[model samples]
Target chain A: METVVQQLLNAAQLGAVYALIALGYSMVYGVIRLINFAHGDIFMVGGFAGLLLALRFTWMPLWALMPLAMLLTALLGVAIERVAYRRLRQAQRMSLVITALGVGIFLENLVRLGVGPETRQIPSRMPTTPVAWLQDALGVSVTWDKLLIIFVSLALMALLWAVVHRTLLGTAMRAVADDKDVVPLMGVNLNRVIAVTFAIGSALAAAGGVFFGQAYSLDPYMGIDLGWKAFIAAVIGGIGSIEGAVLGSFLLAGVEVLTVAYLSSNLKNGIAFGLLILLLLIWPSGLLGRPASKKV
Target chain B: MSLLRLEQVSVAYGAIRALHGVDLEVREGEIVSLLGANGAGKSTILRAVSRMLPLQGGDILLGGRSVRATPAHELVALGVAHVPEGRGIFPSLTVQENLALATWTRRERRHVEEATRRVFRLFPRLAERRTQAGGTLSGGEQQMLAVGRALMTGCRLLLLDEPSMGLSPLLVREVFRAFQEINAEGTTLLLVEQNAHMALKIAHRGCVLENGRIVLEGPAAELAGHPRVREAYLGEAGASSPPCPGTPGSSR
Candidate 1:
């Protein structure tokens, strides 16, 4: 039971981060219907941004650094959209995919030029002091780090829900997803809405990057695997729904963590990917999505 | 003076020209019903004015300035809002969000809230289902939501495409009545409909389209009483204006 409890906490902690990253994937897909291959590296750049900030400005509160990282990465996301995506906005998905791939290669190579393709420590962004919890009932003492991860993640999710549901910008986003062509008729500037979408989505992923750096290790390649996993989660949870992204992340994380604990540690990734393949084979629409039906 | 004009506008889908040299206009503050059979380039005019399609040639002018080459997104700034067929309400969005999306440029939260209330008053059904997802709404409610969404845009000029399609007679009456109320409030409406009788009944003026051209156009009452329109369009509304079979099988 203790082992199971430990695995559950581990899964939740990891799932929280995946949920954040998956939002980026899901939102971009919702608005543009593009895979956005560079999205994974946006997280990478965010971690690096946090890393650089941590190195240069050590005195600021840890909380400040996290948001700053998100802001920085969001700005970069906008820049990437401007440079790579803007021209391709009118292009076919296939053309956009190719451009996205090229951008990914460019970002990876750009990072290589500066940071040189090496693994680095995220540095302890949170305090090392442990906070004990639920040892008596669940027999698993949750650390402050994991607790912060879970609490902050849930908080971010709540905030996102409010902004998206309460604000006009959120409506524009939903409408834009439904029909990008008609929004301009409502007097909305499509370019501005799209920029804001990319900003918010990338910013969310950046927060996830900061969490990921603390929860795991930092590597350029880290975003690739994590990005792929999050995409699978987005697909599994229903690609366009934000709730679906979060739910899917938790499910994928639960499976992966449980496999790591009971099943072969080496087979952890294989199990995750295996489940994704099986899922897509059965339900291509994701768990929460209704298959598209339209009157011609 | 016309509020909207299409001067020899041509729209093409690849090699096939959907609208070739189509000319149309909407006078200021007038409810003009554009009537046509399917594929008679009825929708093509709206699409061109809304600039949703790539214009192959010719020009569209709103308020006498050319808009043919303008981006589709900028049309909203020109005070033109299109209520596309199928409502196009964001299925995943709640009723409030669908309304709120209309105020993107309004910026002031107060006006946004006020517009929400106004739209709610106009569409009490939407107000009742304020928290409901748009996907869950009935067809009538969805159409109401679409009209409400357009109202949120604050555009004085509205282009409605097939607003009465797929609606029952009762719902259709309700929709046309609401459109009348809207037009009464100083908003200009250009309505496209398969329900020509209902459209002409509400409209101040009307135009008849066939095979991508305007065959007849005049005051709503005059056009309603016209023999050809009476035979082809108004009979569906149970109006005994003309015999059902014109010349016994005249290529309907």
Candidate 2:
């Protein structure tokens, strides 16, 4: 039972990181129907952004540093949209997909050149002593970092829910997803809405990047594996639904945790992707996504 | 001066020309219906006016100023509200949210409550279903909500494409009655319809299009009774009308 509880905590931490990164995929897909392959690089860039901030302003708290990374990363996301994706708005879907992959490659190589392809340790910002209380009381291991990850992710998801369901911009985003062509008829500038979507999505991914860096060492290529896993989570949950992305992320993490605990650790990613295929075979639209209806 | 004018406007989807030098005019304070069968470029004309499609030739003037370079979103702020062929309401949004979205371009931001009240008053059915998802509403209710959405934009010109496409005759009449009330309040209407009979009852003037060219333009009553309009659009009932005394190929 103690081992199971320990695994659950680990799963929760992993799920929170996946959820944050998956949101970027879900949101961009919801608005434009593009997979935004470059999104994973944005996550890497975010870690680098945080690294730069931490190196220069070593006195800044994690709270301030994370937001600053998100802000810079959000701007980078918007710039990617403008430079790499905007002109291809009307081009073939394949071309957009190719361009996105190209952008990801370009970002990876640019960071490799800038940072010299060496792994860097993020200066530990979160305190470790707070975990002692939980460790003693519960008689099970619980790190402050894991607890913080869960709490921050829940708070961000709640805020996202409010933005999507309770605000005017949220309404426009939903409307644009439903019908991009007709949204303009209602006097919405599609470019502005798309930009805002990219910004919010990228910012969330940046937050996830900072968290991942604190939990794990930062490398230029780290985003490739983590980003793909988060994307798989988004797809498993339902590509366009926010709730689906969260549910999918948690499920993927749970499966991965259970596999590493009871089975071969090498089988963790294989099982995560295998479960995605199995779930998709059973319910093609993911868990929470409604089947798209045809318009007359 | 006319509120909207299309001067020898031409549009094509690749090699297939939808509108070839199609000249149309809608003066202020008038309800004009563009009547045609499917593929007659009726909807294409509305698309061109809304700037949804680029004009291959000629120009579209809104109050004597050219709008050729204006984007589709700008047209609404310029006072043109286009309710597209499929009644493009955001299905996931509540009925009230759908109406609220229309006010995005309205200059009088403080009067949003009044604008929403006007929409509710015009379509009391919408008031009852204010919290319902737009997609779940019955077709007639969705149509009502679509028109109500347009009204929320404070548009001086309403461009409706196939407003009666999927409604029962009773619901169709109810919508046209609402259109009449809307026009009486000083909004001009340009509607394209396949239900020529119903559209004619409310339209003040009408134009007939065949193969991307205007075949006839006259008062609604005259166009309704024209021989070719009957042959092309009205079918069996049209054959009963007596030929005019002197005009051969009269409709053209």
Best by TM-score: 2
| Model 1: per-residue Cα lDDT over B150-225, one tens digit each | 8887777899999987899999999899899888888899999989889999999988876556788999999988
Query: In CAPRI terms, where does candidate 1 land?
Result: medium
lDDT of 1 by residue, A58-128 (tens): 88677999999999899999988988898988788788999887877777777778876788766776765
Interface RMSD of each: 1.8, 0.6
Pick by DockQ: which candidate is best?
2
Model 1 TM-score, 2 decimals: 0.87
TM-score for every candidate vs. truth?
Answer: 0.87, 0.94
lDDT of each: 0.82, 0.88
Worst 10 residues of 2 chain B by lDDT: B243-252
The per-candidate TM-score of the B chain, in the order shown, comes to 0.90, 0.92
Off by over 4 Å in 1: A1-5, A132-143, A278-284, A292-296, B68-70, B107-124, B225-252
lDDT of 2 by residue, B1-252 (tens): 599999999998877788889999999999999987667788989999999998999999999999999999998999999999889888989998999888888747666888788888889999999999998999899999999998888899999999988899999999999999999999999989988887888999999887788889989989888878776667745365432323222121
lDDT (0-100) at residue B56 of candidate 2? 99
Candidate 1 pairs with clashing backbones: A184-B73, A187-B76
Error of 1 at A222 (Å): 1.7
